[model samples]
Target chain A: TLAAPAIAQSAPELKWRLTSSFPKSLDTIFGAAEVFAKNVAEASDGKFQIQVFPAGEIVPGLQAADKVTDGTLEMAHTASYYYWGKDPTFAFATAVPFGLNSRQQNAWMYEGGGIDLMNEFYAAYNIHALPGGNTGAQMGGWFRKEIKTAADLKGVKMRIGGFGGKVIAKLGVVPQQIAGGDIYPALEKGTIDAAEWVGPYDDQKLGFNKVAPYYYYPGWWEGGPMLHFFINKAKWEGLPKNYQAIITGAAALANTDMQARYDHLNPGALKKLVADGAKLRPFSAEILEACFNAAKETYAEMNATNAAFKKVHDAVMAYRADAYLWQQVSEATFDNFMMAQQRKKAL
Target chain B: TLAAPAIAQSAPELKWRLTSSFPKSLDTIFGAAEVFAKNVAEASDGKFQIQVFPAGEIVPGLQAADKVTDGTLEMAHTASYYYWGKDPTFAFATAVPFGLNSRQQNAWMYEGGGIDLMNEFYAAYNIHALPGGNTGAQMGGWFRKEIKTAADLKGVKMRIGGFGGKVIAKLGVVPQQIAGGDIYPALEKGTIDAAEWVGPYDDQKLGFNKVAPYYYYPGWWEGGPMLHFFINKAKWEGLPKNYQAIITGAAALANTDMQARYDHLNPGALKKLVADGAKLRPFSAEILEACFNAAKETYAEMNATNAAFKKVHDAVMAYRADAYLWQQVSEATFDNFMMAQQRKKAL
Candidate 1:
């Protein structure tokens, strides 16, 4: 028989609890938490295990980060923007209106000093954050009526999440914050004129096409929203170095897997939604431009008031400028060409 | 002192070697192999150690896979397309002319049953493969002179890499497979009229711009190329399940890290290249169309002759058609809006 590795002899068993901000029904997002947990357990040979719980099981979805920070839980898998109400700086960890897309978000976090900057802010809350998942660029929303111009947004009550609502409010839109489950009812009963909830995969699950006829492209505010694994600072520091490495690797794996899942599933869900009479419309340039200016103004206000927000925001904006410049030259060009080929049935 | 865990007490010590297809000078690609090894070792508490070697340490760059296949090396890090001569089906594992982009490729691999399909094919070669790294959309090679149309490519000798050469050869261009280190001198002496490498970051390191002033936009042939970690089948099966899981997670981490590094670094390098007199040009639509048609012909021929190639190619093509249709809807629209803002200096 082969001799066992010496380091393995000293490994300690640990069990952790991870609270997810999403329900199990939203598998892509919630599934990432499960994926991370499974990877950690498998890699550790079941010596380290994480038990996951859906939102509201322990605390409300919006309170996940608070639980982690207060040590009520060892960790929480949630979007950082969900805590923007605590401090606007939290929004940068996930996304901001007109911010980086999925690829750019990963680049910024891993290479452009984003994780270090965000962690510096997160440390203040007694938490440490690692990117766990991303939704890629999202759909604008399902709307009962066409929104052709900035003026069309006036007085519209839309169930938009996080910092996006604040930006849109500048255009005279009424922004309502509602839970995912409540969104369909709100739109169906005419309580809300529009609601944005991820992209085709998740949106289709809520049967948004049944409630709203017109669907819009590009959720500009949450272009590439990232979900994070927030660990209690003390708990995170106490981990064995091996466990820390395993968790980090597992988190990164889950992060990539989530986006891949979204990318693969969205195409088919979109085809189904369209087949079910959901009308797809691009957010007109006029509307996008208007929102862009609104987002800029919102950022300016936060930058003046919040030092942490200012520090991270400035770095992201600088990187964003350069990222888009390079992206347009290669990635966008290739994508555009391929898209044209698809449209022409050349593929 | 507390008692050590049962699993740790029984862990076995193991050391392995990884040979990379990349030279150490190209850190981003070669660095991924180092990253994977480091993650694996750290996660295993140093019980499982994998020493890494750049190309030529254990075997030549292109022969890394063969060494693993014959059990001469425990594993190898290489691009699957580099082994296309062994089997055309191998190209689907890395990339093909006018194939999927980075995000799309990840989607196909992780969520679209791509790994299972490729592994089935690799089983014949006595290997088990995992995605290790990706070079997003690559830049079209540096050129001594501009190539405006397909007509300009006639009789041109280009130092193009694997599989892409076969597709472009249909257009009367002679494709030369020169090693990366030799491409510069070959281009300088006019031994090759043009040579394509990776994007701005790697290309800048090689000083391609100094010899070839005309830098091209998209390398349609090698868009979103993936590199693989090829483990000897017998060695992989002999590992404990814990090590297998750890290796899988580490590879995924390195895979995401490589692309993030490229995306973050490319922008600055591109700026430097342009400032240092690299004239950037887009391949003309006429040329792109011609190349796309040629790629289609090449794929079709392979599909008809090779059953393994047909199985994977058909699935990829089916997914590609849908991926683009959905991408154009949300991702492209959002990107176009941002790029336009960047151009107008409104961002």
Candidate 2:
């Protein structure tokens, strides 16, 4: 409240730089970061300007967690989970497989004490995190061959991204970590059998359907994968509180914009994939079951081994159980009958 | 563009009634409608007021279409697809399973001639449709038991709302059409074996998970279910053009608010559901395949039987194809890797 008087004295000018883990071509997610920058400048009456750079312009995409911690860049947008390499506990900042979807993920981060919890982890890294954007639940991977059994996953060379690779590797999968621009070529050259992308729209554009005929459903790994704008802790602390509020508010707007972009574009894209000889496939029960088990084992191991991962994982799993039960009575009944009738000849 | 100057003119005084398809307790969707009403009042210096009533207060939820059509109410917020029962062709006004998601839906409706095309159909019914809100691609419903094969669907009594019921019925589902308030009693009494509803948060509040043990994924029927505010066609036309613009702008604001509410509340609700012993299941391949085939047949039949269905369906389909392809390339690849990484322990 005291700052309000000071703020009224005069709006100050500020300048900053932002780097994104995505290219400008992947407009929705990348565009959120871009828009966040623009909002900063506009909302400040042109007093605040933020210049943005795509991944690799200044650092490797995966290295953003550290670069921001070191203040190499003023800010950056990347998945908090990407920093799992730095600390497994960082996954809490993004999402976990079979975890929360976009709505729940947002709640946890914003209101569910999740922000403070994750901040503890970030404190150690000398970085701060704000939710930049989220993709609602995603689809499984696009594969060259249909997975019929758990055995089918063994020895598979796939461009599986990030942490889910560790779980899948337990089933004998050889996980390949590649950037967005490189995935298609890898699949095309038979270097990888398949890859998982966001959903229909993005996948179709990359022409993954041509290279991988089989498309799967339910992006279990990312029920709601969240992206974050990371700031050096010292840099964040340096800003006038109003400017900080503006930045945080701008990130929320970008979050909304990012999801809006994907939702608007995904439906039509899925249809195109099917039309283009892309065979949509659900992962076989056996394979899914195996993956689920692997994920559980992985979770238990981490909980027992790492205190931070144990703390966050316990918190999230507790949250999920409570949420799932209440939906069965009201929401489920209404939706089931409605969906069941959707395809009917209107009475 | 020529109307830009006119739209900038001051909004005037008005009072109205808005009948909603949702309960007041379901704050998010209902809240959006309320926000629109409130914004109108404030913008017009308290000259405009809108009072919202839950469905069944003045009329049954499904009858909202007819009520607004006949000018029985000033306005109503529901889905155009809900009226597919009156005109099978109305399905195009909403989403079909695996159809356009939110982003594309907004684009088509606002920019791609979709609103014009939809109004052409709505004109016959004497209602003008405005974008009320959208629940970006929703989760599939929850079930009372695990379904491993298509056989489980035989004689399964379920609450499936909207046009989606038409396709699922082919799999031997005994679909029930009921209002939101009535679903719980029916499900609780064992009147239905399964149900589908909007995902997590709302579902949790509804307490569906208490009754249904098996929660399913991929609500194919409603990839991007959009709600519309229906005004009597004559009533709409009678408004000053500026008033009309205000309504549309306000409706857009409401749309965003509803989505934000859902995003914020869903996670903790889902956490609660799982803790209560609810089971999560994926609809078996056979059932999904069956539904897909039936949807195709339904489309074909409608095209052959009705000219309007054929016209709008053809146009939207073509648009969807192009949209899907573009997103697949850009959004999908980045998401896959990011999601997988989110699930891992730090490297």
Please provide, for model 1 over A162-204, each residue's C-alpha lDDT reduced to its tens digit, 9 standing for 90 to 100: 7999999999999998888899999999999999988999898
Best-fitting candidate, scored by TM-score: 1
Model 1 chain A poorest 10 in a row by lDDT: A1-10
Candidate 2 lDDT over residue span B42-105, tens digit each: 4333445778888789887778888887888989988788778777778777788657766567
Give per-residue CA lDDT, model 2, range A84-153, as digits (tens): 8767888877877667666557656765667788888799888888887777667777888888888988
Residue pairs in clash, model 1: A4-B11, A4-B12, A5-B11, A5-B12, A5-B13, A8-B8, A9-B8, A9-B9, B141-B196
* Per-residue lDDT over B69-113 for candidate 1, one digit per residue giving the tens place of the 0 to 100 score: 999999999999988998889999888889999999999999999
* Candidate 2: residue B152 Cα off by (Å): 25
Kindly report which residue stretches of model 1 are placed more than 4 angstroms away from their true locations once superposed: A1-10, B1-10
Off by over 4 Å in 2: A1-10, A181-185, A326-347, B1-347
Using lDDT, give the best candidate's number.
Answer: 1
lDDT of 1: 0.91
For model 2, the docking class works out as incorrect
